[model samples]
Structures are given as C-alpha cells and as structure tokens.
Target: MSFTDSSKKSDPANPKDGSSSESEKPSNEKQPTKTRGQNKKLDRSSKPKTPLPQKMDEEDLGICIQITEKLSNSVYAFGFRSPPDPTDEDGQSYLSATESPMDFQTLLNKLNTEGYRTVNEWKNDMNLIFDNAFNYFAPKTMRYDSAIKLKDKFTDLCQMFTKSEEERWMIKIEKLCNKYISADNEQ
Candidate 1:
C-alpha cells in the first residue's frame, strides 16, 4: 500500500520519470503542521462564538414598564396602531380611548340592538372623532390625513347621499359609518 510497493510493481520499461521521487524530495513549500482531522478538531474546540445578550439597565427597564402602563391606561385605542405603535406618535387619539374598535358590521349590529337612527341620536360615541373619525375610510398612509370632527365628516358624507329618500337619519348615519368607521364606545 506504501509508495515504494507501488513503484516496485510498475513496469520498469516505462519509468515514472522521477515523479515518485519528487514527493520524497522536500521543496521550499511550507507544509501544514496538522492533519485535516486535527485542524477540524481544533475548529470544533474553538466553538461557534456568539455575542452575549446586552443587559438592560434597571432604570431603563422600569421606564419601559411605565410607558407600557401609560399606553394600556391611555383609553385611546388607535384603529391603525397597536401597542407597539403608541397613540402620541400617530395622533389616533380618541376622547373615548377606552372604547373598542368598531367596523361597519359591528356598527350595524349595534344599531340593530340599540334601535338608533343617527349618529346624532347616539351622539359621536362611535369613537370616530379626531383620529378615529379621520382614520375611518382612510388608507393606511392616509389614515391620519384628515383631522375633522365626527359631525363635519358626517356632513361631508351627507353630500354623497344626495337623494332625499336616503336622507333618513339612520340611512345617512349608516352611509357615513359604513364609509368612515372608527372605534366602538363602551356602554
């Protein structure tokens, strides 16, 4: 199995052309001291080093906790933003912050249950004022675009329903609410 054994078995008629001896003669080339196995073992010993978790300061942690509490108690549940995105930043602030968010279907269901006709009948308690009102019917980017009151927005909505037959208080309210639903107010 050794190099010498192979050389002896070769036909002498055709010489290896000193290729066999070339490996025997050490050249100026630097050789690796360790075998591949040894190198791999060393690599394994080194381990995959990873950065440690950065420690948070107690004060900073406490401050974050405080902010979370304030946001939870803030009453203004923004239609667009969750807790990760706070109220102050987006101005989705509603007077009835504690109210749950309401979509068109939920509003309809509420109307059915409450026997209400117009937003005026229920007041602007739909949580659709300021950010809530503006954000209704608005795309994500245009959500906070219009900062109008619930009543004004309702008026604008009235223009859309030009027909007098649809001028019923409930119908007008439905049209507006369907287009621009904000959040739901608690009982």
Candidate 2:
C-alpha cells in the first residue's frame, strides 16, 4: 500500500491551525522578561589612534638595494667626470673636450675588430659599451659623454635620425641612469 503524504496537513496544536495546547504556547508570552546587566555603553571616541608602518617585502627590498648601488655608482662617475664646473650665462660649461691631435683611427680599428662596424653603431649600443668598460679603469662619465656627443654628431650627419631618435636613445639612457639613482635613494 502507498503511504499518503502528510506534508500538506497542519497540526491541530500549531498557531496556523487556530488551535492550541498548553505545551504549544509561545515562550515570549509566558516567560518573564530579563533585565540587561550593567548597561555600559562603549566610549568609541576615547580609543587610542596609531599609524601603521609601511610594509615592504624581502624581494622588493633586495631590488631596491641593487638599484641604489647602480645609481650610486652612476652618480659617483658623473661627479668624477664633470665635477661641478662653472657654467656660463647660457648654461653651457667651460669643461668641454676640444679636438685632440692624436689619431683615434687605431682605436676605431680596434673597436671594429670587436664587431662595431661604425662609431655611431658602437655609441648606439649601451650593452657594447658596458661590455668594453666593465673591466677598464677609464672614467664612466667620459665614456657616457663621448657616447652622447657621438650620437649628436651622428644625428647631424644622417639628417635621417631626428630629434625624436636622439630623445628615444640618448636622452632615455641618461634618464634611466637618473631614475636608477633616484630609486636607489628611496630604498
């Protein structure tokens, strides 16, 4: 035999059925109310305020240290090279390098043997300069200046390499050095 479902039928003692038993009385109506203890309100205004310290992780700290070191070296090199020479009213320094009588052809030939096809190409590649100067006792500032001057002359010669090209390459390199130093100081 199939059992009839009783889910739809309401109990006689339930309030919804409009009938009640003593056991089915509402506890809120029958029970006495309890008084709240102490009634103490919190003084939120009296709480102490403190600032949180900024958090930097180990990896970030390491990166910051490395960047700082690179920048410090760059700054030291710049100082060594151009040591705060007096500037004219036009803002140009008197410390400019004049043309030397020495033959730079031997040096250019040496550079060519090391895979630099042109002086302009050599100046364009920072990685090449870095590789060449990595173990040299030569001043970095001088090397950087030569690279910049070469680029300037190259632009004038080609007429194809615009101001934007100089901006994209030479100016960007200088800015990167400055940024690296700045980031290093922040750490």
Candidate 3:
C-alpha cells in the first residue's frame, strides 16, 4: 500500500479518527515562524534616536571655576599657604612678568637648584615634599583662608577672563606654589 494510505488506516482499539498519526496532516495547517531579525526591525521602527546635547560657553566657565576650587582646596588640605593678596605692586609685577608666577619655570628652577637631573625625579617625590612643607609652614587657619581665597579668585577670573587663559594661569600657579612651599619645608 502507499505511505499515505497506510497512515490513513485506524487501529481497532482507538478509532476516534481515521488517521493513525496527527503529524501526517499537511504543514500548511501550522502557523508561520518568527525570526530574531524580524523582531529587531519592528523594535527599531517603533523608537527613534535621542538627540545629542548642545554645548554652551557658560558651561566651560563653570568647569574652569570648579577646577580652580578643587586645586585650591587640595593645596590648603596639604598645608600650603593660600595665594598672597595682590597689592597694586603685586598686580603690576604679575602683569609685567613674561609668565605667570605660578608657572613651571619656578619648578624647573627649584629642581635645578636642588641638583635634580630630570623632571621625573622631582615629580616622584612631589607629594612627600608637599606634605612636609604643609606641616612646617601652613597653620590650620592659613589653610582655611587660602581655600576661601582660591575659590574667590577662581570665580573672579572666570567672570573677568577667558576660560582657557585663566586655566593656564591657575595651573602654573598651583604647581609652582606647591613646589615652593614644599621646598621651603624641606629646608
């Protein structure tokens, strides 16, 4: 007999249907399969991409102030004097100087004077030097005052000058001042 005819035959004990097996029915009777690609396409079309945020000049200024404040706080916490109050003479000197007093030039000078051959050598012991200086010269009250002054100067600079220019000055000042204080303490 043909395979189809054999499958159509029913057993005497179970005669609910003429077919012996349910799987022998046509595949067209079953539902279609869903794929991962199809599901992803549907998900993509359902939602849109979020737009990028806009940049602002004011945000840059705010960031500059934040950086300055942090540097100031760190210097004070490490027991260094806050920046000196600028008198008219100090202001004039600062303006006339080719570079900011806080610049790395001072650091280079200190390293040379101390007989260090490389910048890396100075950088390695920088923290210890800073701590020793802080312990020697900076009273608790001075640290508090310096932190406050540093915050104020940062705000004033942000309002009065360009962010990038102010940042250069602030960085130079921070490094030089820290180095000087530390060196003095070492003595």
Candidate 4:
C-alpha cells in the first residue's frame, strides 16, 4: 500500500485475466472543482454597505460633551472615569470579558475633537463603558452594581436630553407660526 512501491495492482473489475467490465469504467462527465475564498468573495459583495459617518454639528457636539460630563461626574462613574489599565491585577479579566472597552475620558476626548459624528454614536460609546464594567465584574460585586447604576443614570439623562431638544424645536416652530399669523392679520 506504500505510494513509492510503484507496483501496479490488478484492477477489481479488470483482473489479471484481462477481462473488463463496462459498469466499472470511468465516466466522461467532469465533476465540478471548488476554489478557495470563492464563497467568501460572494458573501462580502452581497453584504450591505454601511454609510459613512456624518460630521457632528455644533448642537450635537454640545449634547455629546454635556452627556459625557454628566456621566463622568456621577458617583457611580468613579471606576470608569478613565481607561482600564491592562497591566494592573484585574487587567486580564477586563480584557477577556469586554469585547470593546470605553471610558469617560476617551468619550470626552472624542466629543471635544468631534470624533463621533452623531449623538447616537457618542451614546453607544458611553453605554459601552458601563457594559464593559458590567461584563468584567461579577454580578454581586460593587463594580458591577456601580455599572448598573451608571447605566440607569445614562438612560435617564439621554431621555431628558432628547425631550428637551424636542421641546425646544416645538417652541421655535410655534413662535414661527404665531409670527406668520400676526403678519397675515396686519395685512
């Protein structure tokens, strides 16, 4: 059975007697061959493209800064105020559990430099900070509890921020409508 033997064995259907059977002959039809990365190319091409990030406007940038400031100032945010130190004792655990890490300082830096294009993008990073903390710390641990509190605070802050923005827009619209009506009345 060694490949290097170079000795030819008699075929099962066509034995040493030189008799051949028609059913055992090779077929003329060629079997299809598969190439590497063929399916990967199709998958990548078929995937939907994500739109590029838009630049953050003044108002959006202000909101981003304000949210980050508020979150950073919270008592529950003490642990997540800065980036995690991977060289520290708990570093390996943090690195292992959190897929993407975030911190208040990093968020603030991004906001100041207009790193995020939308409020939602900034919000996602903020959420990631708490999520990372939660993932790294055990359920009953103080750090985990802190993360829960911070997450709740962030949620409340965002809801209030959105409502205030909507209210401001509505007030502006109402004033514009009033001015239009007053101008029509004067005519």
The prediction achieving the highest TM-score against the true structure is: 4
Output the worst ten-in-a-row residue range by lDDT, candidate 2.
94-103
Tell me which residue pairs clash in candidate 4: none
Hey, what RMSD does candidate 1 come out at? 29.4
Sort order, TM-score high to low: 4, 1, 3, 2
Task: Provide the lDDT at 19 for model 1.
Answer: 36
For all predicted structures, in order, the TM-scores are 0.23, 0.16, 0.19, 0.59
Residue-wise lDDT of candidate 1 within 1-187, one digit each (tens)? Answer: 1112244454434455533443355478988798667765445646867743344333323333343233223334234223223356443443234244533334434444643434333234334334344533454343344333333443554343354654556665786686665444321
Lowest summed lDDT window (length 10), candidate 1 = 77-86
Tell how far residue 51 is off in model 1, in angstroms: 71
lDDT of 2 by residue, 1-187 (tens): 1123455555765678766677786576665555785456788988997633243233323333343233324433342222223455211221232111111332333343544333344333423333333322245566545544443443454443335755647765887899999999999
lDDT assessment of candidate 3: 0.45
lDDT of 4 at 71: 76
**Best model number under lDDT:** 4
Across residues 87-150, which tens digit of lDDT does each residue of candidate 4 receive?
Answer: 8867656665667778999889888877988777888898888777765677989889999988
Q: Model 3, range 49-124, lDDT digits (tens) per residue?
A: 7643332233343443344345435554443323223576744443343122232233334433543443234333
> Whole-model lDDT, candidate 4?
0.77
Better of 1 and 4 by TM-score: 4
